[model samples]
Target: MRLHFLGANKQVTGSRYRLEAAGLNILIDCGMFQERPFLKRNWNDPPFPPESIDFLLLTHAHLDHVGLVPRLVSQGFNKPIITVEPSVDLAEIVMLDAARIQEEDAQYKAKRHQKEGRRPKHTASPLYTVNDAKKALPLFRGVKFREPVQLNDQVTVTFREAGHILGSAFLEIAVKQNNATRRIVFSGDLGQWSTPLINDPTPLDTADCVVMESTYGDRSHKDAGTIEEQLANIITDTTQRGGNVVIPTFAVERAQELIYYMGKLIESQRIPTLPVYLDSPMAINVTELFHRYCRYLNEESRCNFEQRQTPDLKFPSLRLARTAKESIAINNIKGTNIILSSSGMCTGGRIKHHLRRDITNPNATILFVGYQAQGTLGRQIVNGDPEVRIHGRHWPVKAKIAQIFGMSAHGDRDDLLHWLTAAKQPPKQLFLTHGEEDAATALAATIKEKLGLKVTVPDYEQTIDLT
Candidate 1:
């Protein structure tokens, strides 16, 4: 058996892994590269031939994990991609959204190319179109949790609750090769425990080989209880002087999580019932999905699920901004509104407009609810950048920009350690992926020192033989 580390090895963006065992070829995740330079590389041609792989098993619908499917299919990969039901549903939104951005970005780059009197550095073709994304949709085979299905003669796969987002999972694979039976685990973006809507990550009894993620390996999250308090304090301080709150959140989990917390803050009388505009139409779609799949929610989250539909379940101030005109309306809106927008990392989206408008106000607050990848605007703001460029214009950062650490969907260092403690026995070797160099290296050291286990952080596109 051979395991190939294709992408997202030491870096946080693209996530693709290949496995060859018992004459079966499979990929764990076929994600896309993101952020500057990394995202720019997406047009360089296929990293590896997508047609050669047998199947893709996605953990969730995050673009970084499932964004490349359309491109893969467009390049003649005619294989069924399998995931849980919610992931399949959410992928519809995520990939289509990503496709639109890719289209716009390519057009922008091509126009600049024309100005330079040169053919575009990149082909004007997008990674895939919305139609392409939809074409790939029917290929999805949604499996229920813990149900093991044979992918081919070589392997059987099971999904474990990752607790990160709705329908997120860690895959467990059992392989039969060369008259030997082996079981391995892929920790697909482990989620923190006690998160609002999802159950805790399922514990593993043991594995022979393990692939883990270390997104927050160097740090521990703040106490979860303080999230609301910090949020309330930021809101009160910012809005007391009549400033708006701009939250750059992921349209999927992070956006909904903010809504949950904001709902709490409002219901608990922690903050005044200011208008909370969900500026992304895609995010509004995801909220309806949550309502459709209410069974996936935690006990508390489900309690809010209407057994009987009540018009009051929808908040009057909870405005859904679907069209471009509505999004632009937010720019001129005034007085103590909390507008949660997307591209959580502030890379691109309507949030950039909000940031440009609100960041110049001394009393406005820019709140971050998730991990911002390096080279993104949200990270720069968190790092105290005094000025930032938005849609080709410079915006001064006079707003009170702040972040709450505990709101991350990914499990922190402590949570990873706690998850490992239940392993009963450590694997022969652990490979850490899905993190920046510093975080992955730090996690590798901690896993060895604290857990007395062997671990290595693999480089991108490196391959290892499991003979």
Candidate 2:
């Protein structure tokens, strides 16, 4: 078997991995690159010819992990793609959102090039369109958690509960090649243990080779109890000062979690009883999907799910704003109300407007509850940048910014070790992906010291053959 590391090998963005075995080709996580310079270089760096690939297996629907779906379809990849239901629903929004951003960016780049008086050989265009996104949707083949489905005579894929999001899974692929069977495990962004709204990540019995994410490989999440108190305190302080609070959340799980937390905090009287608004259309859609998948909830959240099964699932002060006009209207009538929005990293959406409005006022607070990549507006805020440019204008940062790390979706180093040690025998080679250099390095060292396994981090475009 030949394993190829195309994207998200050394750095954490575009994640494309190809495995060639037994006269079959499988592509995993055909994602788009994010961040400034990397996004520019990777989105257009001529993708591998789509025809050569036989199938695409998606690992959840975060934009950085599934953003290139429409592009792959547009580029001639007509193949069966497999994903869970929530990931399928969420990927549709992710692809369309990415297309809109790319088109908008392309327009700006073209105008600048024209002004420079150099007719470049190429003009920028969107990576894909809304229509392409729609075209890619029908090809998704849904698989249930912990069920083994045979792809062909020689290969069977089983998905385990990954605890990351609603439908996230840890995929184990068993392949029969050269008259022998080999099993490979892909820990697709292992989630933090005991997160609300989903089941926890179940470890595999064993595997011949393992590919895992190292997103938080160097750090541990804060205690959920302590972080909950911190969140309550932040909101109380802001509302006491008569200012609104803005949260930039991922349109999927993060938004739902924030909503749940708001409900708990509001009901517990830990914070003011102000109205809470969900301002992202995509998030609204995903939340509806969550309502549909109540059976998948964890033990604690399932109780809340049963409560929401009542007709009036909404609490007294929760508002789901799904219209652009409704979102814009927030600026008009605002007190100490809390607005949760997307994209989580503050890269786009109504969150930008919320930030530009509330950031200049010292009374408001911005609560960050997830990992912020380098070069994102969320990271800048978390890192205390005095001023930031948004929508071509500079805004002074006066809002109180606080981060609650316990709510992160990804697991910490301890969780990773726990997951790895559960295997009967250590993996033949542990390859870390989807992390920064430092985090990956620390994780690799820890794996060596604790588990005493031979591990290596693959560089971009590197390939390793398992013979």
- Candidate 2 residue-wise lDDT at 103: 71
Clashes per candidate, residues 3 or more apart or on different chains = 0, 0
- Per-residue CA lDDT of candidate 2, range 154-257, in tens? 99888888889888877788998778879888888888787767888897677999998898888877555565687888888887888888899998798888
Query: What RMSD does model 2 have?
Result: 2.5
Cα-based lDDT at residue 327, candidate 2: 94
Model 1, span 322-383: residue lDDT tens: 99899998888778888988888887777877888888989888888888888877888999
| Deviation of model 2 at 125, angstroms | 3.9
Regions of candidate 1 where Cα sits further than 4 Å from its true position: 108-120, 123-125, 223-225, 306-313
Clashing pairs in 1: none
Runs in model 2 lying further than 4 Å from the true structure: 45-47, 101-124, 223-225, 306-308, 311-313
Mark the 10 consecutive residues where model 2 has the least summed lDDT: 305-314
